[model samples]
Target chain A: MKVQSVAVLWQIWSRKSFVTSSTLRAFSTSLINPSNSILMSPSLVSLDCPDTWTSGSVQSDRSSVQKYTSKHVAQILDGKVMAEEIRSGIALEVKRMKESIGQVPGLAVILVGQQRDSLTYVRNKKIGSEEVGIKFLMTMLPDNCTENEVCKALQSYSENPSVHGIILQLPLPRHLDEGKILGLLTLDKDVDGFHPVNIGNLAMLGREPLFIPCTPKGCIELLLRSGIDIKGKKAVVIGRSNIVGLPMSLLLQRHHATVTIIHAYTKNPDKVAHEADILITAAGVPNLVCRNWLKPGAIVVDVGTTPVEDPECEHGYRLIGDVCFEEASKVASAVTPVPGGVGPMTVAMLLHNTLESAKRAFKFS
Target chain B: MKVQSVAVLWQIWSRKSFVTSSTLRAFSTSLINPSNSILMSPSLVSLDCPDTWTSGSVQSDRSSVQKYTSKHVAQILDGKVMAEEIRSGIALEVKRMKESIGQVPGLAVILVGQQRDSLTYVRNKKIGSEEVGIKFLMTMLPDNCTENEVCKALQSYSENPSVHGIILQLPLPRHLDEGKILGLLTLDKDVDGFHPVNIGNLAMLGREPLFIPCTPKGCIELLLRSGIDIKGKKAVVIGRSNIVGLPMSLLLQRHHATVTIIHAYTKNPDKVAHEADILITAAGVPNLVCRNWLKPGAIVVDVGTTPVEDPECEHGYRLIGDVCFEEASKVASAVTPVPGGVGPMTVAMLLHNTLESAKRAFKFS
Candidate 1:
């Protein structure tokens, strides 16, 4: 598992880089004015000629800067609303297939161990599949199961012919080798699309993945449904993890958007974040994206899922994403909330992916 | 074939393009001193904003001006020299394999048409295979051969125990379904590395390919040999063809470099090109990367193969790469010559790939 060297990987990211953070912040503040002789690009990013690279000295030219207006309201990309719409689209397709060919899609779910979060996720996935009228198979393996036992369970489902799509619930018990198990699954049945081969395909230009991971797909669906122009947009993905942020950058670039990935170790993450036409944050940090860390009228998609204790709520804990939603709504155009933004759409897409997998596998109507 | 729409593609590129020759020339002049005072990242680029999004300008204060020094000449990266070293390395390995295994690696080349360049390439490939002591098999089918014929030829070689590597020579009798036939070749034996799946793996971050297409591999090998630091460098590939430029960008990025790709109809190709620490030109346009366009000390890898009249050579026409070699060499700290640069490395890598395929398939030392 990559986790064995996880400490080394984390250490690589923990060091304070050579560039000064305060210098970067000051540069960002200066770029805020609309008409003070705009230095088109900062030298910080220029890699052409270090000898010729000059520092911008303060000139006494303070031209007029545009003032912000309060009329702007956040265009909530309510994922719950969009997810329901997509579910109906899938349901209609499923119904059509059943009527014409009597073929129904089937998805097999493998969950190892009894982690509370994993149980809840597996349950939600099962419910979502049912709602879409796809046949679902669930296998619960004990925490201490051997690799052979897990392999046997996977082999049966893979050879079952009835099982079209397969998903192994993530963050398996501590003893398991995650990468090996994920790689072992058949490419055709890998609904999560975490297979390195599939990911490798996604990174290439002109090659499309059989299935893109759900969150990135969900983000695309949200953008396209909202009629947003993705082409050549200055998009910043505020994380570098494989599942959400990296794939999101590739997908956005494929749609022709110019993308930059800023992560925790980035020297000036906030300054970089502010330059985005579209900002998608999945850093799992609370309030990492402040209102000031945004360009006016930019679209924001926050994918973080952190829980905060709230005594007033009956559940005692409330869900929140990485963005400061209240502040973002005041300054920027549109935003997706923590609980309803990307969360609901992820499950809805899983069902969508299952139906797709079955139809492709069976040559159904 | 993509050729059907290529004319329209060219028309689209030639017209409605904001990429003026004058602007390209300005970028050439600005290569000397990067003036951060004036630039607009292509106007057609999106903001993902609503109709009510107001236009704003950014002020450039001197205090805000950053010291921009391009870390251009980290070291010299000579592709031609490195290619010779790699070829010799492969020769030693092949000799050892022949002695121990009692069989040499064999590569089957299937050519379906008589495209002048394709024939020339096939002849050279055979020569290269012989030089490396890898057995070369060439099957020249007629231009009128059906798609099934090509597939059958590939399948026969795939089944042959002696055929360690296979390639369906490209520009493949244009009428044949190139995609389907190429897909049929076993991924393990795909020496051309053009199979979309193999190309995908090459472009992925953590994924590794059994065979990386020769040109990009040569480019990286050159940089590594020259002691150039690629990590965290900003690289821009000037063309988006699947063969070289697009994959080149992805490979650089996967190595932790920030990469940008420009293609036909790209609004500002020159602006993007200036950002590269390692510049690779495969556009086939003669003299594409000129003296004015080069950032001093940039490592240039030339992969263009345009035949231009040169009575000085016995062939009556001389071979030239995408780069204006003479001018680029003067401005660039190091540059690869047209004939001697990337060409030899490509053939060498093919030999290396066949050996790699044999090693993995037979588990040889």
Candidate 2:
């Protein structure tokens, strides 16, 4: 059987056709025995195929029917491509706003302590914001910066006429209280959407947050732009953290999907996971979800990016997502790759949120 | 089969023994056919049974064995009793505060427009507050009051030195945006916990809201006071309203329960409800959940108080909860009765929150 368009793939995924039932039964068996759940080899599901997509344990999307020696693979939910598309649109908007308002949107980031990951995130945010013509400002404080200093920094950014959005990078020194510092950001300037008020609005049905957390917003954007309908679908989110998991689940629910959160205390996580039509994993545990944990033709979003030590790689470490991509590719109809997946989208979304905050602040609309 | 002692009943609820496995299988059949879910003759699962305390459902407490009935029943999670107990403690604290500080805790309520239910609630709140020696100050506005008028009233209450807690009654006139007026309430004076900041705090894991929404807080109080272990339990909240369902689900999740919310758009809600170990319904749909919708021995908290027209009842209407009480009693291990259940606890919780706000404001221990 050859499948060409995503619409067809969605049909197969939603219908759970006879062709995929055997593969599903096998995957179901793995759920019953979680120890054997992981598939040894990872397969990259490429949507860049116009070929015979035959049903088999080891399938490929190569154009030649004769090359179909393997099982059915997943279609890649290319976040990089989507992020680039969004960034382009945001850039156009930024240009329009600059022309009308005589100033570009500005985003301020306050980073305390020198954590490698935090530095990388701030750098990416800066690059992404500049790419979209947003004025990027960074406030770096010493490792031993007092709580008053951090609060003062936030207060300055919040009051700055040019700064439309403010973000305080996470994982401050152990002694510093993140909540107290985050609370210091004015709700209007809280571009990261980490403030309780912003999050609270997101959780409420009738209310809308000025900004949604970048990563989750990016995940939902990918799904929406891909023509995936969230309403009435069983969307299972793995993890319950405020940043990604909790808000993502709430967003999906707001879109009319039935959401179930599988957390640390959840019993029979694998079995519960198999029931989801759309599965999103944000639990930073690398390779925690195996191929069998997903229902056949399920759409998977891997938000986890945990760096595991690997001397063979240039960085001496490789970032792995929560899901085992290879095995998952064979089972899930669509899946996101770690580095190119949620990572780029998250940065793009941060700029998008900043732009939005700027538009509201300047009344550019 | 007569069983004595709540310990024996708890064992039956938790163990899923041979007797209940068969019972569960029979009830599980109702999922495929919701029309047949409600049993014709509902049996109340009572704890008032007599017999030597046995391991089975029929075993009764030795002291109460003589009062045992043939049919299995649920133990009532009496909210009235619990709320009264909480109020007594709060009252003592109020009296102590009056003695020490020469003034009792003060709660100011601002009510706009005259809705019958809203007036009733306000009156009840005043009586409850005064009964506990709390200074009750209420600001009543006309039905045609402007949004500014409402905000000005809230401002007055916020500025009142004696008023430690301020509540703006909800469902203001349709012309007025409740969000705008609600935003005016100071976070410290937001005793209702409807402020975005407070709700946001509640949604966060490490941070606690200054005040939890009265209704949901009361529900959690009932569960905790009843000794029901919330950890690792499968909790299903039926509704996503900001007031009750949303916060209740968050509270349950915070307690380490794997939580799922079933809303109006949810497909196969009955199937989802059947999976819950603890079910909380805030759907406001009268008799929406039937006996078959529950897993045998599950605990239920019904937050709905819909006034349905009933000619047989005085006032030409009767209050009904989301759960079909008579039907639910047969399946649930324990269930709160509608009238005396979450209703009274809600009021008590409002005062409890007010007391807490006062304690914080006055530096009372």
Candidate 3:
């Protein structure tokens, strides 16, 4: 994965640190434990993996785990590479479906306002969709559009036979009820999966989600690409936003990773940061993390992206992530830098989801 | 607050011998150690109350905890009465709103199929809603209704000015997609708060849930009613179902309790249970929990209700919860029973939500 992709995934997961750490921890420890009834050991969170040898058990590398070995560290979770892989996979499926079923996957982006960031995001998403071979369409509604007008327009698209997936850019106009406006998308066509039902299903373990949030999806892409063992590892997510943090934690916990979420309000946030095998920092604060807050050999994902003034930069500013990269690089076994980390991954996942929507719509998967 | 309630609460918290032994060991040895972040400083978990001094510390007597003199323990939480209190609170608001605003809270129940249990649950929920002074309406769709038809009906209720909350009763016919139906409900009218947006919001600690699921809501009721201080305590949620287990764990974690979710497919489920100050069992298994599964003074909320044949009972069947109530009671400081414990509280919370929906619709608040 590209370094940029990891940061985006990190930000998403960091948003869920407080709750994810402890829950994901239970998953890892419980995997090898056999003391409780199997009800808690349902097939999904089955801890049938290798028994965590006693704390004193010998390792392939007898050196302290603080030192890296093939066993301790695998390939970096490059979201960029993984995103390419997913897009390529989707493109192949799109090609196959076009030939075999005479249909293509379709994703419709709904932009309600003219925010520059939203515009950049949508443009990237559209391009990503095109790259992945999913059919893409978009609509721009005026900022002053009433909730009913927006609802009516969305209803038409939702009922349209050809539209398989729909996404309305975030930070919709102030007058519209964000929740109600998002509700207008069809569940099957809800490419963003911000729909409450998908979220509810995601929250419930053992159930599957129609669509997962983009950032968490990106993080999962990192984990799968890196071949890291999430089951039973202590994962901490920082931040608690609906878009990134909460759902990211749920996804990790579903994979049986014990997860903890740390938030701005947490009394001892720093103490919580040190407990992670996987540390995700999504709070937007620049240089919020120091070396002491990290455990030895931890894999860190930095999700923060703040503009800090730099005299050397031509733009008069440089993009910085939530983590203090200089300090973290030494303490963390490996870390994803801010600008090149999770950002790229989010775009890739969006394309991936759009492709998925297309495939499901076309009955290709 | 009351003798019976305190016993039930204690029985809910503490379960069995192995749990007690391991917990006792962990508690006694950890307070003085800096590495033990899992257990926080003594001052955080408990208030400056008498029972807290005893229960919050190690080696506190099970019998003594029964007294629950702590402000956060026996005196603070009582799920049964607390649920009732919440219901009455809602009822009072509902009555006031009806008198002042000429509008009653309206809840629409969509019951699909003829599963006996599902039907019973829907009916019970309807009764509970009416009892709280929320207007209840039912739409019983055929068991074999098409997913599209269900989606349309759910949408209608979501848009209908009369309906403030819409509930699609669970265990829909196997042919209909649950995700699609859940997705169609308007997020604002999603009183159950099963929608992804709401759930995604709930999973992040600081974000407030627009609607909290009935099961987890009920679990909170159990604790608040039983006087258990959730802050900075070790909580374990057994089962990771999005409905009861995962959300249950997250909500507890939000209260500042360190929560772990043990689920099926988890490597070692029982070992995780031993670490909990509070244990919530939501896996739908009968007698899944034995005395050995619980800590002596741990609180247990058994959310599962499974039916088993019992020739001794006149009905020829008996309902049991996830915990072995009788055996667990002796060992646990408090326990919620299979039939009467978390079950009623779910309905009560639903009613409260319905009333809330009405209040919001009428601007009563």
Candidate 4:
């Protein structure tokens, strides 16, 4: 149960006015040039050059400078639409399996504690699974439950023949050893892809992981579906969490992108970020990346989803991304929006992984 | 089974004259300044700035310019000396175990082919093990040996009470599935650390690998013993091989170094290499890196060892490194020599890993 810090909220609030103003400007620009609206932005004329861009800048040139002023408003990647399409395809596959073999994929989740965000995430997964015609199951435990209780729940899932994919929701209670719990899950049933062997396969050359952690897999899906080139591109991934950033970097490298990983201990992250032809930020720090941190026309994928309190919103809060959306949209060639971006795709990928696992189990594919 | 390319030999021969001239100059500088000889060199004054170093160079400054001309001759990171020290320490520990419990560690190696280089390497491991009071065993098979034979060999060592560490010599015959064969070795006895689970643990944070691959572990030891600071430093690794480059980058990241991996598809590798405070090259391309590829005062670890024909030498060939030794010596603060550098340290680390595995098995401290 990690809480958003006050400093992060303060930073998001401080930029709220700027976001509003820039959104209006972007909208006006789009209205003025409807046909090429996705690539045209008038507000980019005033964008500042990154601090690292100097006369002797290795990656900077007159052409890059000229291209910077001709700002390309980022086309929305629209992961929501992509995920919907994918889910529909998955639904059809499940239906086919049901009609042919009278069987459907089964996914089980073991969730401990009652963290609001985790609860919401689990609910979404359940809905997503059920919508795809897959059976969904969960085991919820109190926050103070013993390690043995959680292990028991995992053991049941592992032994169940119907359970094709099992996910142990992360950030387990403080007392339980997360690694030990994860190791106990049968490798073939580890749909979450947190097992060491799965990760090792992902990192190694000429080997494939049983499952790629959902978020990074989804991000790659969005990129591929958008027809963006990854081979030989310079990719920079911010944050090195095992789930997102680390695996994302490895996946990108597998796709032949020259990748650099920036973490908390990195010096001058902006300078490194600017070198990226494709930038993926999973720092979870809202507004951490600004316009100056980008290379103009670079593809930006924001995996950060921090919830900030907003009394005016329907849910009394809003999701913010690592990038300032308005600022990034003015410079990047394409960008994924917060709520409509990686989130939906992550859920979609989970369903896809489960279906694949079930298919393997049944030897149907 | 891997042979050096003719193009690589030609490149080495072309650079031979320059290496000779610079070595003499370096020798003269050392003679003049015997007290501070390790850091003083006269040849650095003529070194050229890296192509990426421009007026707006993010990492370049007046101090860097002055430092460039100061020409700090690289102090040798002597793996030979370090390996000797470490082996002596292992010998004492093995003696203590023998006296206290009447037990000693045993290492088993399975060599599927009689490749000259692989045979030499296996022989060295045997000598190193025996020197440290560990029992040494080898199972040699012809190049045409069947996959079943290799698997049977691995199974025997795996079940043997005396054998604590088992190494499957790499580059198996073309007919054999390398991964499938390596997988046959039991995890506890996987001293070479090629097991995917071991690599996954090394890559993931908050997890520990049972055994780290020998070469990368030895490179880190060299840097640590040389007093080179890794935390927060920009480290660049050239090549992405499973055994060296991939694990090296992950290990450096674990040490808090901001890591960037450069491979064949990487554009402008020298520009990225120049940004590193610690540069490790395992590209296997002889003299692939020059002075311009390094930052002044960078610590370089050369893992490349390509054999080039030399009738004058007793072995009829000499090993060449990826970095031009003379050029790197003039610019870098420290550099490891190809043959006596990572090679010996790798063997020492193998002995260390075997001892640790044996201790764990015997329940010895």
Every model's DockQ, to 2 decimals? 0.07, 0.22, 0.14, 0.26
Using alpha carbons, what is the TM-score of model 4?
0.84
The native-contact fraction of candidate 3 is: 0.24
Overlapping backbone residue pairs in candidate 1 total 17
- State the TM-score, rounded to 2 decimals, of chain A in model 1: 0.80
TM-scores, one per candidate? 0.75, 0.80, 0.63, 0.84
Evaluate residue B251 in candidate 2 and report its C-alpha lDDT on the 0 to 100 scale.
Answer: 78
DockQ ranking of the models? 4, 2, 3, 1
Over B57-90, each residue of candidate 3 has an lDDT whose tens digit, in order, gives 2221123233322332211224444444455555
Candidate 2 TM-score, C-alpha based = 0.80
DockQ-superior candidate, 1 or 2:
2
Q: What's the CA error at residue A261 for candidate 3, in Å?
A: 2.6
Candidate 2 per-residue lDDT, tens place, B98-178, comes to 898887789998888887667766777777787778899999999998988888888888888899899887777899998
Query: Which run of 10 residues does model 1 chain B get worst, by summed lDDT?
Result: B1-10
Best by TM-score: 4
Off by over 4 Å in 4: A1-66, B1-66
